[model samples]
Target: MLEKLPLGRPEIVVENGKQTTVAHSLKLKSAHIDDRLLPLLPTAMDAEQMRQRLAEHFREHLPNFEFKLSECHIRQVYYHPEKQCGVNYRLVFDNGNGTVFHEWLYGLMIPQGSATGRFERAAKRVKTSRVVQPFLQDFPPVSQLDDLQMILWLFPHDPKMKRMPDAVDPDFMKSQINEHAALLLDLPEAEARNWHCD
Candidate 1:
């Protein structure tokens, strides 16, 4: 079972002319993973299955909000000679009325070098950040839509992150948009091929 961690609030800070959003006062109590599941850890379930599990977990704990799973993938991070592989999940949850929304990223690590594969740890904490609103206006009126539709509507209109002063990384931004479009919107392969971000 996943434990609930209380994260106080969200704040925005400007540093070196860049805007960053951060959450404070969030702490997760210790969580243990079942040792029997180590070997088949991340790959045991497909992305959709993982997303469903995440949604259920959050719904159980956060009954006041609606949850949407935005992204899920197996990720490996290198630390010098050692590497750690885990499942990374990005989720967006909103107040039932859609007046407020928060994004949370979670990481679950898998144990390595063990004969019986097992999950090493549950997510230590979920750092929640507010979704960036477009400069011209607030998020569209998406309250009436279902969870998936609300996410798709808000995602495309999300303000692109600025890499530096008055500039954006077009390739990186396009890839992000394209990936979400393909995955969430289920765009046809040919249509996705022709999609362009500008």
Candidate 2:
């Protein structure tokens, strides 16, 4: 299991002399691989299978969230005994009420043998397994259509790092959301694609 960890503070960005802080990163916990499955890595399972296994583990162990491997948009996966094993993927959810939410997950598998022991010793704390928490306490909750649209507005910015979109008016956009919320949320799927960063 993984222990819960904050994804760090929101990043501050300045574009065209205006500044804004973005908050959208998902919180994650570290999870260790089962010792019994150690040998399967270099033998029974390839990179894709390993990713699948970890994703399934999360879905099975975590409560209040759901994801199908088929619906996942896996962006990266890599494993190596000498360094680390990690996976990054995107998950989308629909509330069936004209509201949808999307989140990105990144997990790093525990390193084995001496490295694992060293990490624990260095931190001077015993590690505990935990299920991932989807959002930070400070994040705005999606209670209605407007809230969902606001979250969607944040999709293009990375919460963990400072980034400013080109030609964007951070303060103006924030101020104008109430005026444009309905039109933005009612946009067709094809037109809405323009809102996301490429």
Candidate 3:
């Protein structure tokens, strides 16, 4: 299931399926290909462990790739009526922008043509879009989203390293993400055509 981005419950998983959307909004339900799936995050013991897992996972998953998590700052503890206790990890990274890993999984999901062209089209469709077209490429996996307040790659809850895999399903992931999106945006579906996955 798509847990809240970054700091939400790490139980959401993304597997192969068709377009999955929340009932009210168009947030990405789990997308599928060949009944296979992309992965999702799982719980971490703590911030330190989470950091270790994600750092290594990226290196192993990408070739000739090196990303560092710097500016390791933290937000003051805050509580969400919904999130219970939510904390923000402030960090910067070197992004191949999932360019290598994306091709390895799904041929570059970013749309073709001028990135501006794609963004313009996508922005027109997504009502929640505040600025110009936010093409999946314009934002990429690294660009920050005003709504998500995240770069998307910061949380790698699931690992290729884990012995026992823990995955959340499409339906569950969609529900969680949709719920979170609505809570965050007060809009139904703000998902763009292309996914800015990490």
Candidate 4:
């Protein structure tokens, strides 16, 4: 079944000095996965841990790359240790070809002693707000956590595809997430604090 379906989603294919979005062959960044591989994802938030997970999957994966905070204007901003379980972590990665990639990670766990009924009730109240607005019914693919966590990486689309309002663009979405975090979380001025990586 896995071999019958394409190994990965279609992405921009670079031709002879011209770039076009096409269904290229399998590459780690673009390769789709089945349930068996999801368990390899990093369970912790440490930079090393995350890179290690990626390395384990992609042979050519680069663990060394310069990255800035998701929110550059903010200083000393970090995720809340205890509340970092829910949908979070939006990051931008330079593809080294003048194209940028956007990656989003999400996981929402009901706290201990919190009944499912109460959690569902709270989810209903806040689902429409900026906090988890992107998550409602999105049903994004789970990351390596095997259960509640999932990740989605957005690649550059063709010009017409990009023109569509719902086109995938990581930087734009990252800003929206930052803005939502600032407002909903009541973060400090000039700083964006999160329950996980920006």
The residue ranges of model 2 lying beyond 4 angstroms of the native Cα positions read 1-70, 112-198
**Least lDDT summed over 10 consecutive residues: which range in candidate 4?**
71-80
lDDT comparing candidate 1 with the true structure: 0.33
Once fitted onto the true fold, the runs of candidate 4 whose alpha carbons sit more than 4 angstroms away are: 1-43, 54-84, 109-140, 147-198
Counting only residues 3 or more apart in sequence or on different chains, how many pairs clash (N, Cα, C under 3 Å) in candidate 3?
A: 14
Q: Residue-wise lDDT of candidate 1 within 1-198, one digit each (tens)?
A: 223334432111112223332323322132222344343332322455656765664455446434354444322111111122222233444444555344323233333443122211111111121234332123221111122111111222121232321123355666778766666568887777777666
Residue 159, model 2: Cα distance from true site in angstroms:
13
Per-candidate total of colliding backbone pairs: 4, 3, 14, 4
Q: Candidate 2, overall lDDT?
A: 0.35
Q: Summing lDDT over every window of 10 consecutive residues in candidate 1, give the lowest-scoring window.
A: 119-128
Clashing pairs in 1: 38-117, 38-118, 39-117, 39-118
- Maximum-TM-score candidate: 2
lDDT of 4 by residue, 86-120 (tens): 22344444445565544433333322343344434
Q: What are the C-alpha RMSDs, in order, of all predicted structures?
A: 18.9, 17.4, 19.5, 20.4
Candidate 2 per-residue C-alpha lDDT over 1-198 given as tens digits, one digit per residue, 9 for 90 to 100: 113334542221112223322223322122333334233223112335534653444444444434443334444433444344334445544545555556554433333343344333422321221112233222221111121111111222222222322114345456455445557679766665455421
Task: Output the lDDT of residue 21, model 2.
Answer: 26
Q: Model 2, residue 90: what's the lDDT?
A: 59
Q: What is the full ranking by TM-score, best candidate first?
A: 2, 1, 4, 3
List the candidates' TM-scores in order. 0.28, 0.30, 0.23, 0.25
Candidate 3 lands at a TM-score of 0.23
Scored against the true structure, residue 194 in model 4 reaches a CA lDDT of 37
Ten-residue region with minimum lDDT total, candidate 3: 102-111
